[model samples]
Target: MTRGSLRRIPLRIFSGLLFAALLDSQALAAAPPEVPPPYIAAPAWVLMDHDSGQVLAEHNADKSLPPASLTKLMTAYVLFGKLKSGNLKLDDRIDISQQAWNAKGARLFLRPGSSVRAEDLLKGLIVLSANDAAIALAERVAGSEINFVAEMNAVAHRIGLDHTVFMNATGHDEKGHAATARDLARLAAALIREFPEYYRWFSLKEFSDGRITQYNHNALLWRDLTVDGVKTGQSHSAGFCLIASAHRDGMRLIAVVLGAQDENARVEDGQRLLEHGFRRFETRLLYAADIPAVRPRIWMGDQSTIPLGVGRNLYLTLPRGWHEKLHARVTVRESLNAPVQRGQAVGTIALDLDREPLAEFPLVALKQVGEGNLFQRTIDKIQLWLQ
Candidate 1:
């Protein structure tokens, strides 16, 4: 069902007993279909809706684990911030440091003192999973890897990645370089939503620098046409990890699979989560932002009524067959007075799954309401006293 099809609960001050009765009546409104989430194969995994920021399914989603190359997602986030702030440029040449040249694991074969464009380094960091490239980019952005890691952690905190910490630029299995599936999913959403312009690079299948060519490690890109991006990581300590995003029809999903046994297991787990999310859940835009939801009477005001609504669109990620059962209740202040300003938090909109509340949204005054003239104010005062 669409947004217009949703049955709205009328504006009314419900008595406690009446409210409880209505909840019972609402519970029998619709017989919701059974759509259970599939079991995720990884130790830590999360499937999230891109538009509504809803978690469809997860296992050990908040458990901290080594990020491996999944740490690169945060690295890319920090770099994207620098690029947006004009602190770094894609075309600017970055000097390769000795530390980068001597780095272990995947390599871009950059000789010490050789200058490479930041754009090229990005390709190496993503497609190639090059440790040296990650270090070089980090050094260029923060002057040293040590300071760059600090920036990464700071960005993690700023973005509300509560379960993430970075001890190095590369997803090298350091003692403290760790992240959770939930945090990685949030990182993936931030990268795609906040920096769509730069996120395009994650879709590239391969990057070749004359002599050597490197293909992206994410296998879903080849197997599924809708699969686009994200990143992959692996180490003895962290296990194989993959963060993947896919767009199907008009919906997009981000899947994080960590601590898988092997490459195939990680890829399979990510694919399964994405498939289940798209098949089982559907995102519906229920309410437009800043629109009048309720008109509650204002006492002693020039205008007798004031509008109320949430400031943003209310998009709900619901089960495939549960749309008609969804309804919302509007609760407003009992003693609303004159001089109410626009954008004020006057009430709340609570969406319900029968008697259980699915989500709650704030209701705000849509327009200003000036105090009434002396006569109206005096009448309201007398009414208040009589009550």
Candidate 2:
């Protein structure tokens, strides 16, 4: 080629590369701006990333304390599960027993011998923290409050709430009824995540029963546009407890405050936690389910490769400034014996930030691999011996 033509070719290649680099830089710059950390003051509180389940800030998060009306969160959780399972319906009418109406705390103005639909009662229990409504729903679901409490504890365990115990449906500060801030946040998250339809009850600012109109005790619901429905609790011993969730700019956060000195403090602390969560962090989807992270070698198996996957969806909650430092490592067993079942956990994928372990999820087998036949096994054994 002529010298001039050769020089022109080089110039064109350089220009193409420069244009691609500029486009990449512009795309990165177009990403959303990071939030700032919020200011807060409360003795015991927790801020968590709603999508990733990462603890952003914790102060006495696991210290066991009376959940007070926060106990109603568990009550609502059980009721929601029942509704989802078809055991209860919105329009189903429930008879108000004397025990439910006269249980002695947080009445929904329910009158004994009166009938109300399951859906309205739930609103009373969640929005109003009505003890009567909670008891009524519990009785309807499990035949008795005692049995229903058992189911509540069972669900708590299933949700990995290790520090929770349910003594009654109303969160009346009774003996043995308590949960920590972290535990309550987990319960709140479960409700929002597992039962989005039923969780809407928390968002209702007002509900009436033809005689009286009750307002939600959670003050943040009205004060902050980002705040949404979550339960609040108060008692002489439990002080004021709240599980508040809010969504801002596509990010959701759950904040829990237990044993605050007054109603104002509870709301203030909750807002602080939420603001901090939204400001300091961002939720990023890491890897999805059934997406292979690594290939596991099978010993004496017919298949040459076993695809490794996570058991559930994976996400990471990281500081906005540390997005570039996030990293992941997949650890799998060197070799597996035949007879692996699909969905069986075989390993773990650990997510780290600056070499610190942030989250770990079980890595599972994506497909089943049957055990080799006797002849195949014998051949494999010979091959192994040779190796």
Cα RMSD to native, each candidate?
7.4, 11.1
TM-scores for candidates 1 onward, in order = 0.83, 0.77
Compared with the true structure, the alpha-carbon lDDT of candidate 2 equals: 0.75
* Model 2: residues with Cα > 4 Å off, grouped in runs: 1-40, 294-306, 330-340, 344-352, 355-362, 369-387
TM-score of 2: 0.77
User: Worst ten-residue run, lDDT, model 2?
Assistant: 11-20
TM-score of 1: 0.83
Give the per-residue lDDT digits (tens) of candidate 1, residues 1-387.
Answer: 111133457323111110000121122233344567787778889998877677788889999999898888888889999999999999999999999999899889999999999999998998878999999999998989999999999989988899898899888888877899999998898889888898988998999978788899889989999998989889999999999999887678999999999999998898999989999988665665655776777788887778777755556566886766677877787688989998888777877665566666667887899999999888878877897
Q: Model 1: runs farther than 4 Å from truth?
A: 1-7, 10-35, 295-307, 334-338, 366-387
How many pairs in model 1 have backbone atoms within 3 A of each other, for residues 3 or more apart or on separate chains, i.e. clashes?
A: 1
- The pairs that clash in candidate 2 are 35-279, 69-233
